[model samples]
Target: MSVSRCDIPLPENFRPEDILAFHRRDGERLAEQVDDHGLKKGLLWRGLPSCLELRFQPGAARLSLAIDGAAAADDAGRLASLGRRMLGLDQPVEAFERQYGAHPQLGRLIAARPGLRVPQTAFPFEALAWAITGQQISVQAAVSIRRRMLQLCDCRHSSGLLCHPDAARLAGLDADQLGQAGFSHAKSRAILALSRDAAAGALPLDAWLDGVPVEEISERLLAVPGIGPWTVSYALLRGYGWLDGSLHGDVAVRRAMQMTLGLPDKVSQPQAQRWLQDFSPWRALVAAHLWALLQAGGF
Candidate 1:
């Protein structure tokens, strides 16, 4: 299969590590799947033919981004719109900086990488399902379960690439079937419940966006049978690009924060909540940055 490539101006001071972290969270491990090479700023990947690649570059007044795929030329405008939406372009970074400035660690990191924004992933349902798959398990174990579930429920394109299983298809599954896909009882229940809700239009995954209040959306998300605080927060950050949402209960985030800030132990939930006061409306960016810090061995 022939490969194609393109580049867009990355958000000013964008770090490759941040993009790679977002891609990892999105379950797009092009680096692992393809024999490819390039800087994070202008990434290039070759995978199963016709794979989509997206990037964001910060601009003076707005963000500059690029999307490359066999279909990219036709989808440039849509891709650019998606990029703007994903990077929280609608929010003023200065506002976020003012609120979160008290945290020297977070502030320093942001300074080092100005105009840094959390890149959003496209697959919202997949993201929710993956979060459930990851609950209480090691990252490797989560990946294994996700692979099994996708293999059982997802269909491969003509080019041999797998797309996320559709809501209808997955909604047809029972707990037994999901368990066979390596999900535990709870995880299986959660995924099926999520699929059913999404399939029935109870949770309108597509319509949720940055303009919506994080707390409000999270409440609705929690109404789903298997969704919880962590899952809802994860979805907001990764699925909808809400810059102020934080995974306060997330073990990794807690650990990363403690280490980054030199706290002796993980911040308590209340403490985390208080900490978030410094990052309101941009807590999501702080969460992304902390996650990146963890990935980079800084925490």
Candidate 2:
């Protein structure tokens, strides 16, 4: 195994530990591990199991990364890209903060957690698959099912840590296999279709990240079997790190909005949608803040 290391600069007030904690929250033992030093995650680099370690100091302005395993020594460009996505470094956080830092509804929340970000999966297909798994399910249930699916794929690094399975590994799976991992029939078909489409290059998953119009990407994703507005929006948010996707349809978003608004009645999807429209390009970022509110015990 080879080892490669590099340091990535961070923007002012960017908090790497918050990103670390988010990844740690739903960590499946085999796929990744997180602690004070930083995150040690298993992933596939060039179709080989590789380990990525991120180390940083509190209040530091940079992150140090170490990539280990086969083909790990070179590929500086790919590893840096992966690190940025994993840390949400490409997000227009400062822009969002500048626009909404003083807004009445979100101002306080943003003030309390200035470093909040919408953490993304390492791969686009991973986000899509996770979105399918989470459809209409409780977060806890989704995590359990996701852990099971990871075990089912069984792609492990040389260090014996399991890597998050890529589209090809997932595409080879059948409905029965997914069902055994707690996927409903509809979800199984949806994930299988998404995996096959991605693995076969039928879906423009990567291009969506490369400046495609959001409407076109949304339309394409919505065309897939069993994919709905919520799934498409969520995949766009988590996969592309796009902050504009409307997440009002999400139950947690509505619930958190209700709490933020101090409303006695539940915040309906339409009501939340209308309210969130005010944030426009930052709607999803606002939604992320509300979700963080709930996670931070504000609800």
Candidate 3:
């Protein structure tokens, strides 16, 4: 195995642990790759097959690669690119703090957390499958199923790391096959539909949209069987890295908002939207902070 290394810089208020908390809600997340040190390692892509070990420093981020041979050498570039994208290496941390650091409610969170950035998946389909499978289920349960599904697809990286299932492989399968892997019938069909569209290049990934309204993107995604507002906002928030979205529809988000805001009952979806309006252009950040806060028992 050949090894290579790359370093990515951390922006102001960078908190590596916060990103880990957001991405790794449970220790057993099948699609997530984080070690005890918070270092993450996984394949560049299912096809590329190289494994990248990601470590973060206070001032910079480091990537270590283990490649099979010359065949996987070119994939190093792609590894770095994905690393940059997934880690939000270029996210404007101070800029957001400067904007919302003084807000009465969110300011407390900003002051408490300091630097928390929204995490994104290395692959869009990973988040898509997560969104659909996780519907009405606990995150821990969804991660468990996600792992079983990847094992069924055999999407392990060449360097011996688990990764999300590839769209092409999933697109060709029947619901029963995925069902055997622990997916609910509805989730299996939904993932299959999404995979089929994505594999056929019919579905649009976040990268395909530039300057597109968040609602418009949400509309396009709704055309898919299991895609919904929560999924769309989640995909945009954690997958696309868009900050102009919300987790209002999510139970955890609702609970977090209620507990934090001292609301007596769960806020309705529309009410959640109205509440999150003030955090426009950076609602995703608030979502990230809320998630991290919950994990930290900030409530």
Candidate 4:
């Protein structure tokens, strides 16, 4: 496959390294390689396995991009769109800062990391799959299972990088197949059902990106078995960049909140919900900041 190349303009003062650091947090991930300078990951574009390499152009406000294995002639436009979404170039960080910069609890966090932006999955289904894989497990354990799933799918680019399995591929799997990847029975059932729905076009994961009502989307996602507030919120955040999904049910968010607020005990889900309500409209962003605070040992 021929390599397709392009240069994507970066937002002013945008630190691509921040995004790289987030991707590298759990150590080297399968299907992807992350370094101090860039990320190289395999993606399924129109069900075609392709390797995308993004390198930051030092001292320049642009990213040098190369896609190996994409065949479309007009891949540049697709590349730019993917770059903007994956890099969060379109996130309204300034608006978030203006609204919450002086927040008593989050003020310091915002000041500390003004360039923070939520990195999104290349596709919504990947986010949904990740949310299901990560349920009730430590991040490291989830990463292990995800790696196994990728290996089981056996989708790879010519360069031998694993590609994240798309819905059709996942929908074809039985519980036993996923069990080998360490998915519990309940999670396997959930993933299979969701994938089948997605592959059948019953679930419009892509359409939801087009200004769907958050409540409506949340309701639809909740109707799926084994999916709850946390999974839906996480999928929306990473999949749609929807920022206010009430992530109070998240254990890490609660732990971060407890420490950030100087509480001796972790706050209950309901309590965290009430406290996060004050942040409204940006609750997930607040959660991101709290996670950053926890990561930085500011608590």
Clashes of each: 11, 0, 0, 0
Please, what are the lDDT tens digits per residue for candidate 3 over residues 74-165? 65676677777777765677789999889877788889988776667777777787788788887777767777776787666664666556
Candidate 4 runs further than 4 Å off: 25-29, 59-70, 296-299
Query: Roughly what TM-score does model 3 have, to 2 decimal places?
Result: 0.87
Please give the lDDT score at residue 125 for candidate 1: 70
182-229 per-residue lDDT for model 1 (tens digits): 887877777888888888988777666535666777888788777788
How high a TM-score does candidate 4 get?
0.93
- Tens digits of per-residue lDDT for model 4, 1-299: 65666677776668776677656644556687887778888888777888888888754334333445446777777777777888777778889999888888788889988868888888899999999998988777888898899999998888788899999999989999999999999999999999998899988998787788989988988888888889999899888888887889878889989987889987999999999999889898888888777663111
- Clash pairs of candidate 4? none
User: In candidate 2, residue 219 scores what lDDT?
Assistant: 85
Best by lDDT: 4
C-alpha local distance difference test of each model: 0.60, 0.80, 0.71, 0.81
Greater TM-score among 1 and 3 belongs to: 3
TM-score of each: 0.75, 0.92, 0.87, 0.93
Q: What tens-digit string does per-residue lDDT give for candidate 2 at 71-153?
A: 54457766677778877888888888898898888999899989777778887888898889999988878878988998999
Model 3 regions more than 4 Å off: 1-4, 22-33, 44-46, 68-76, 204-216, 296-299
lDDT of 4: 0.81
